[model samples]
Target chain A: MTPDDPKDPAGQHETVPGTSPGASPQGGVVPDSRGEFTPVRTDTPVADPGLPAHQWRPTDVDPKLEKRAERQVAGMFVAAQVFVVLFVVSYFVFDIGGDGDAILGLGASTVTLGLCLGIALLLIGVGIIQWARKLMGDHEISEMRHPARSSDEDRTATLEALRVGTEESGIARRPLIRNTLLGSVGLLGVPAVVLLRDLGPTPGEVATEQPYEGAGLANTVWADGMRVVRDVIGTPIRAADLEIGDLVNATAAALYETNEEGELVLEGTERLIANSKAPVIVVRMEPDEIEDVDGRENWTVDGIIAYSKICTHVGCPISLYERTTHHVLCPCHQSTFDLADGANVVFGPAARALPQLALAVDDEGYLVAQSDFDEPVGPSFWERG
Target chain B: MRLLNRTAGRLSRHRRRPVAGLLVLLLGLFATGTFYAAFAPAQAETTASDAAQVEEGRELFLIGCAFCHGTNGEGVLTESGTQYGPALAGVGAAAVDFQVGTGRMPLVQPGQQAPRKPVIYSQDEIDALGAFVASLGPGPAVPEESEYSVEGLSAEEQEEAVVRGGEIFRTNCTACHNFDGAGGAMPRGGYAPSLKGVEPKYIYEALLTGPQSMPTFSNGNLTPEDKADVIAYLQESEEQPTYGGFGLGSMGPVAEGLFAWVVGIGGLVGFAIWIAAHSTRSLKQKGTTE
Candidate 1:
């Protein structure tokens, strides 16, 4: 550290007890004026424990034993080779998948290939380890560690060399060039930071700008009258079909948009985005059991109540329902919501209740969303206000 | 004997009627009734056997289950109102079949959960128990084997069902049952049991019954076809070997990651210690003072 640099915590040895002033090799560890080496520590907190006496291995003293060990290690290496051959042979001999019978629930080929290759590698590793342990030149060698810091003379010489180079280059005298070079080098990192913007659009940008109306963080494509369909199969849920204690993972039918050719119009990323926000789990309980949320009296058709599947805690899709208790648990963190009581958080870390999607039945008797969620779904953010 | 008595009583009542008329009517009725009853003894035997089975089931229940379940399967409650055994009134054939078939009922002792134990009841006894419960009220009936099997589906359709079932399983079953149906933890001390090697009929009944903490995937929620698909997938999946590595308990990444980190890293750490501290032969210590 430069003595003139105020920011640097220079002369730290003066404050720290373990590292006294002269103990620092950076200032060059020198002898006191008495012409004798000054002890680095006169009062040792603990005495240095010397190395214990080493024991001799049987293979080290006995020639016959050493020969036997050498043969044993060689045998392992030979066995490794045999397994390697077996692996190669098994490749051609065994039928994969459905053709041959399974062994212990594993395919014939998988079992043989895996066992052979695995044993070969295991043998090689063990052989090398045994050879190292038993037959190699084994001695307890103490390596004296050198001081980590460079010599004071070397440090001074390096500083001097750097000073001379910089002076010759006129960098210190030419502040204009030096500052601009620093500025340009620092600016070079900006592109890397700026490139991260392409990870996705800003959260609400899709809602404000995307062609699909209200499809983003603040809104979903689940508009009024959109049929609630099964998550993967995309079959619309008929209200009559759902019985008491039944839980169905569902989403808006808008997610299954198609073109004339029967290809999904909402393909890839667009569908994923819309579907993520609109995941709904429709569950039916006895109508008498429901404790209606204020102003949401008509939200349920019969006993069928639909709510967003996304957890209020961190947005993991939750549908581990216990129909008897009317409790739904989130697997990620045990946040439980009482579906009978307006989807309120009865336990765990969820700060807000699960957002409910009001539902209606269409003329075709399919369950449909009355509207998008009144409150924003999922984990809270700073800008949620 | 009862039928003969009823016929004799009817004859006495019609004693004042014309003799020919009474004789002709009695002959026609007796011949048709007797012939049908003899040939179709099957129909009459079913009703008789059902009543007999229910009676036998009731006797078994009184001996084994009544201590907790009460005399008529009308649940017994501990003083605090916590259910000792929930009422079996509407639980029906499916619930009784799943609980008894899995050997979860007739609990050795009460606990937070009923783990799968050695099934004490024979198949006939279990069916009798199921029939007894079914007589109590209308609820889900025990599923037939055809409902939960791939017997009717074509090979191509079976493959399609497996794919569909995988998706459904991930959405519905994976949270508690785990990704590979190896089972995982529940809210308190309860756990979802592994679906591995479980009979297809039991799986179907379990879905219908909502055994323990498992939610009901009723025929309505997961249609009969969906249930069949799930069973087909589970059966097929159990037969297939793990490709990547050890199943590692199949609790998804948590167990697998813990295993790798603890075993792999811990092994390396122990190896490092071994390398540092061990040597086969002794040092001479000639000029090793430094």
Candidate 2:
């Protein structure tokens, strides 16, 4: 504490008559902790340089230049106004249909109105920016900063108030109420968990009516002796019809089967449920090209092999077949499978080789599935195990 | 004339008995046959130009393609067992037209694929080459213009054709050619060529032949009408000006997402730089730097 004044308890400054704490920036004698004069060597290598001299913008120096800048900013604002009016005019001038050529594909009114509004907004923004950059203030002002921390007394008072509030609330003392509140808050999540169940039936239940050997993701509608029909046409494919390099997209003939009155065997939702599972790509390559696997030797008929089109990585259909190489690639991800081999995964994200369908020919020489796919088709699930 | 006169002199020298005369006639026929063999090709070139197209094509093929494709269009193989050129037999005139007409053949150099280039052969010469290859085996014939053209369909009919074609193309072509026919990558270091601006005739022939790594969609799999419908769909989609600016190769999300990351973020960084440049600190630094 300075001996000169009792109010200055912390001794922030020397008892020097005229100089304040920061008034003397360089070497100056002041009272230290011992109350003795101490010469402080506070010399800086570089002089403390303050804010640079503000350069005058052309608008600031010359009235003529300032007027021109004002005019330019005004011009942009006027252009924005004109576009706003044009936007309204175009909305009336062009129709959504009929003469749809406002701007290739997008309806005339839609493109024009959108373009005009977008431009108007952009112009107004640009005009405001230009006005600020040129016509408005170019001076760079520094905002003085002070310590953000509160005073020691104020900090102590706040902490004391918080402690009192907490003590009165009795949150720590009331364990029974706290535990029950936590329990109720946690149980609130039950409704949300139950709501998600109705999103759809289990992926397998759709085909429950028919007691097919495989259930849900495990099986498709393909059965023994089922003809593999061409995709969109639903016509049965003859093995002879496929050329050496031909990759035919086929579905099970059961999807197209008719009953006594000729109603489709699987209609609407049943067909939709079964359709994705049933698609198989039948590719014909030379017999010598195929890499033989045990038990799969009879699966191919005359160098023709059938594989599930769905990718093993995700369920994207795999049909990009290269004839000479006998590779089929999935477009979703570049998962390449060698169809000539046992549909082995040759490249990319697919973990397993595509499921192979045992293929045979019917009495009429039409290609047919000997049995269902050997395993499940799509991506792996928790229940797959 | 001298050859004819010599043959006649040889005929006269033979004996003139019943059995001997028959033998003499055979000798004369042999001489005439030798004379014709020596001069007929030249005469065929000079007199019957229309019939000599295949012959002319053979000569051109020998000069341009024989090194890799052999003298008889029988393919050659490398020591590695990879094809230098596959045999042109049973590949048809349509295959020849697609390969050569599109300038994918007479390969610049052997590689994984034959990329499209400027057509070197004239239309007439291409026809002759096609004819020559067709003569090698009974392959598909070149399609008539009417078969591939969709100009005959009414607007409504074309719309219906497009819908049908879209389904067929999605089922068959979308795996490689992509949903928009912008094309996608294939196995190995191969690519499915973009179908944009491709002629309907070449599209037809390509579907028939399969070309390079592409699988053939045989006539049995997709009928001629179905093939035409695919062409119709492609043409219709191409004619409808792209809805969004810059299709980004129509590679779907991959390219569009890449563009967003590059350009969208790039624009923000550029604005940041401008703001930094105009800041009070940088402006002061700029004054001192000068």
**Considering only chain B, what TM-score does candidate 2 achieve?**
0.78
What is the DockQ (computed on Cα atoms) for candidate 2? 0.23
Give per-residue lDDT, candidate 2, residue B207. Answer: 94
* Per-residue lDDT over A1-385 for candidate 2, one digit per residue giving the tens place of the 0 to 100 score: 2333433333333334333445665555456678665534343445457787877665666667669979999999999999999999988887755454446655676678789999999789878877887777767788644344565688889999999988898878899988999999999999888888778776456434355423477778898999999898788888888888988999889888899998987877778867878899988888888899888889999988899988989898778888887878787778888888898988899999888898899999999888888788877655565
lDDT of 1 by residue, B1-290 (tens): 99999999998888767886878899999999999988799878998999999988888888888898888889999999888887888888899888998899879888778999999999899888878888877889888787888888789999999999999888778877888899877766777789998999899998887876666777767888998888889999988756534677777789878987999899978977886576545343423332
lDDT by candidate, in order shown: 0.82, 0.81
Candidate 1: the clashing residue pairs are: none
Error of 2 at B113 (Å): 1.8
- Write the residue-wise lDDT of candidate 1 on A1-385 in tens digits: 2323233234332122333346555443356688554434332445457676666676776667779989999999999999999999989987666434456655678888999998899789878988988888766778753344565678889999999999899999999999999999999999988898777876566434556655556788888899999888788899998877778888889878788999887877887888788898888889999997899999999999988899989999898887667888998889999999999999999998989999999999999988888887888865576
What candidate 2 gets wrong by more than 4 Å, as runs, is A1-50, A53-75, A97-111, A135-215, A254-273, B1-61, B122-128, B145-158, B187-189, B243-290
Off-target runs (Cα >4 Å) in candidate 1 are: A1-200, A203-209, B1-79, B118-132, B241-290
